[model samples]
Target: MKRLTIAPDERRHIERLVDDVLAEHGHWDPVQFVTQAKTVAESLPLRVRQFFRQIQSEESDVAVLSGLPLSPDLDATPTGWDMAQKTGAGRREEVVLALCSAALGEPFAWGNQQDGRIVHDVCPTPGMERSETSGSSTAPLSLHTEDAFHQCRCDYVALFCLRNPERVGTTVVRADRLDLPAPLSGILAEKRFRHRPDQSHVGPHGHSADVADLDAIMFGPPGSCYLRIDFDDTFAADEDDHAARDAIKELYRHMCDAVERVVLEPGDAIFLDNYRVVHGRDPFEPRYDGKDRWLKRVNLIRDIRRVFLSTGVRSRVIS
Candidate 1:
C-alpha cells in the first residue's frame, strides 16, 4: 500500500477548492460536476497530484491520502444511504472525494445502486445489519472485487472515511501477494467461473440475465494477475464441473490466508485498485446513535468511453 499525508497548507488549499466548487454548483450534483471535476482537479496541490499520478502509473494495489479537510459542522451519520441522499448529508465531503478521485480516473455509478448517485453513502442501516451490502453491520462483508459481475467494473474503488467511532477495520487481499501452487493457478486461469451481480445491483426488476457470462477467476500475465470473484455471487459455470468448484474453494482459502486489515481514520481516503485488490469490512456492532461508522464511496474507471459504449449513451450512470 502507498500512503501520503496532506500537509496543513495542502489541506487548506483543498478546502478552498472544495468551497469554490460548492459555491459555484449550489447543489451537489456529481453527474453535472464530473465533466468539470477533471479540469478542477488539475489545480490540486502539486504533492497531492504527484501522489495520485504515482498510484496510477504504478498500478498501486492500495493507496491512501490522509489528513483531508472534513467539515467542522458535519452532520450526524445517516441511518442509511437513502437518509443521507434525502438530507444531502456530507455534501462537502462528496465534493472532496469527487475532486480527489478525478485526479486518478473518471467517476461513474450504477443506476440500480443507490439511485445512481455518483458518490454513495456507506453506513449501517437498522434492518440491514446482516445483509451482504454495505449497509450490513454485523455480517463480515466478504472480501470481493468491487462490482465483480460487471464488464465495466471500476478500475478503482475510492472510500473516504467520515466517522468511525468503533475503529472498524477494512479488510483487503492483494492478488500479487497470493502464492498458490501451479496446479491451482492453472485452474483459476481457465474460464470456469460465473460472476453474479451482487445484492446492491438487484432492483425490483430482479437480477440481470446477462450476468451468467463465463470468465476466469484470474486473468492477465502469469506472475501479476488481475482478480474478479465474489465469494457470495461467484460460482462455477458448470455445476457438474467439480474441479472448477474445488478450484474456487481453494482460491477462497488462499484469499483468507492472504487477508490484510486497514483501519481508516476520519479525513483519510483509501483508493483500492479493483483489479489488484479484493476488499471487505470486519463485523462491528452499530450504536445507531448518529455516531456509527460512515464512509463515502465512489467508483472510477480508467476511461469513460467504456461506459458510454456500454450504455449506448454518453452518460456516466449505467442502467
Candidate 2:
C-alpha cells in the first residue's frame, strides 16, 4: 500500500517517452511505429525497473505523476480514421504496453474489441441480471475481483481515466493492508462458495453450468491471486454451503466499510495489483449526452512465459 510518487526527473522521462512514441508512430506508418517502439523499449533504465518492482511487490501501491504534457494538437479521439487507416491504434497501444512492461519487468498483452474475441466483460447488464425487480440504479457496488473464473487470471488491471462522471461514480478500493476479522477470514480461506460465469459476455453458447467453488483466502501466493466475482442475482450456492456464502457476504460488507473511495478525474490512471485489492464502482445517473463517464480500461497479463494467442483480446465496444 505504499505510494510511489514519480520523481520530477522520472516524470520528465515518462513524458518524453510518451511524446517520442506519439511523434514517431502516431503520425508516421504502422510498420515504422512498431519497429521504433520495440527499439525504444529495449533501452529503458533502472529507475523504471525499481518503480515497477515496488508495484509488483505491493499490489496496492499508487503513483501520481502530474504535468504529463499531452499533445495539444491531439484530438479527443486520437485514433480516428486519419490515424487508424495509416498507423493504427494497435501500434499505439503496443507502445504504451512496452512502457508498462519496462516498468513492471513483465511482458504486457492487450485486450481487443473485435468480434468473437476472448475479452471478459467485468460489468453488469440487464439480460444478464438474475431478477428484473431489483430495480436499483444507483446502489453501492460491492468489492470483488475482476474475473476469478478464468484459469489464467490477470496479474494487473490498469484503468486510465479518459473522462469522469459529472456526479458520483466513485471507485472504491479495498486494500489488503487492513486486517480481516476472524469469522470473515475463515470464510474467505475456505473453498466452499460457488460462482457462476456471466452468460451475456459468454455469447449465445447457452448457459454453461460450470460452477466455481473458491477459497476465500483472496490470493494463492504472496503476490499471486485470482478474482472470481459477479453481481448477477441468479448465481447462488447450494443449501449445504449457505453458511460459507453468508460468511463471504459478511466479509465483503466489513471490507466495504473500510474502503478508500477515489473519484478518478480525466488523465488519472489507477493500476490495481490484481492480487492485492478488490475494486467496484458507485453508480451515477448517466447523461448519455456524449459526456457520460467514459474511461479507457486496459488489462495487462504480467507473466511473459504464459502468453497465448487465444487468451488475450480486447472487450467489444458497447455501441
lDDT of 1 by residue, 137-230 (tens): 9999998999898898999999999998889999999998999999998899999889888999887843577577889988987556899989
TM-score of 2: 0.67
Worst 10 residues of 2 by lDDT: 128-137
RMSD of each: 0.9, 6.6
Sliding window of 10 residues with minimal summed lDDT for model 1: 203-212
**What would you estimate as the lDDT of candidate 2?**
0.46
Relative to the true structure, candidate 1 has a C-alpha RMSD (angstroms) of: 0.9
State residue 314's C-alpha deviation in candidate 1, in Å.
0.5
lDDT, model 2, position 131: 21
TM-scores for all candidates: the values are 0.98, 0.67
